[model samples]
Target: MTIKVFDTHVRTKTSRYLHFDVLIEGNDTEKAQAHARQYLLEKGLTDEDIAQSECRFCHVEPGNPVVAQAISQQGYYILELQGCQED
Candidate 1:
């Protein structure tokens, strides 16, 4: 599985979280989601630390390159199974 990571800014009324969006490439949504959760856990993210996020395949066109570059610079494999897929 191949994946990319993007820094995401999530803000609430009280606080903000500097989270990461794990972008996975594959035809299967189930596989992608699984890979993402596992990767997060290995990086020390608890289950509560992750939120289900979706990125439309269409919008991924322009943003793909930029995301790829960022992931490369970060030096994280961004691909590994940490847990089973959730329903």
Candidate 2:
């Protein structure tokens, strides 16, 4: 299972949280989520730690894709996905 991760600059009204979007090739939501969760765990995040982690799916169409947009806009890549929160 190959997964790609990209950084997203997510900002809300009151708070700012860094975002990492994971891109998977196939259209299996369950598998994609599992892979993402596993990746997070490998980074040393306990299940409890990422209970509130935000993840979403993207449906790309011809000529433009959400993952591509995220990478271009945010300048994030797969390597940035590794690592747990440093606090």
Candidate 3:
């Protein structure tokens, strides 16, 4: 299967922006953003904090077994690039 990668930035309540990549099953940016927001919520961030998030389509590529499995189970896979520890 192929996957879409979204380059995402999210501002925390602590006033720091986090950089991460979201890998999902489709090319829809809104769905990717939603998944990113859900991840932040699961990591103890509030909706206000997630309100400042920005997500853009970075690229698309063929999926391997690991990420494919992750997306199948959780609907998305987070690939942290820099500036945060919410992985």
Candidate 4:
């Protein structure tokens, strides 16, 4: 099993967004997104929220989260239909 790590975020308040990192053991991006979606559902987020959300596959050195990098270095490719949020 190849475990992939994802850094996801979503808008909660008009001016605030929540963030989380999830590690899912799977070989496909589809599986990863599904795992994240389920996790968000368990957190009380609705399907509508997930449908309107976005995701990204990021790369960073081990032990370093992308957020720890300088803002200029922290960039993400917005994946389609896959951001997670807590209600």
- Write model 4 residue lDDT over 8-87, tens digit each, in one string: 76664443454665544333556556655665676677666543444455543333343334222422222223333334
lDDT of each: 0.41, 0.46, 0.85, 0.47
- Cα error, residue 86 of model 3, in Å, equals 6.2
Q: What is the lDDT of residue 71 in candidate 3?
A: 95
> In order, what is each prediction's RMSD in angstroms?
9.8, 8.9, 2.1, 9.8
Say which candidate scores most in lDDT: 3
Candidate 3 lDDT over 4-64, as tens digits, reads 9999988766777789899998888889988888877777787875547789999999999
Higher-ranked by lDDT: 1 or 4: 4
Give every collision pair in model 1: none
Candidate whose TM-score is highest:
3
For 1-87, candidate 1 gives per-residue lDDT tens digits of 245333233222323233344454433445445654565456556556544443222223233565566545653323212222332
Candidate 3 yields a Cα-based lDDT of 0.85
Cand. 4 Cα-lDDT: 0.47
Q: Summing lDDT over every window of 10 consecutive residues in candidate 4, give the lowest-scoring window.
A: 70-79
TM-score of 2: 0.46
- 1 against 4, candidate with superior TM-score: 4
Model 2 regions lying over 4 Å from their true place: 1-18, 61-87
Residue 8, model 4: lDDT of: 70
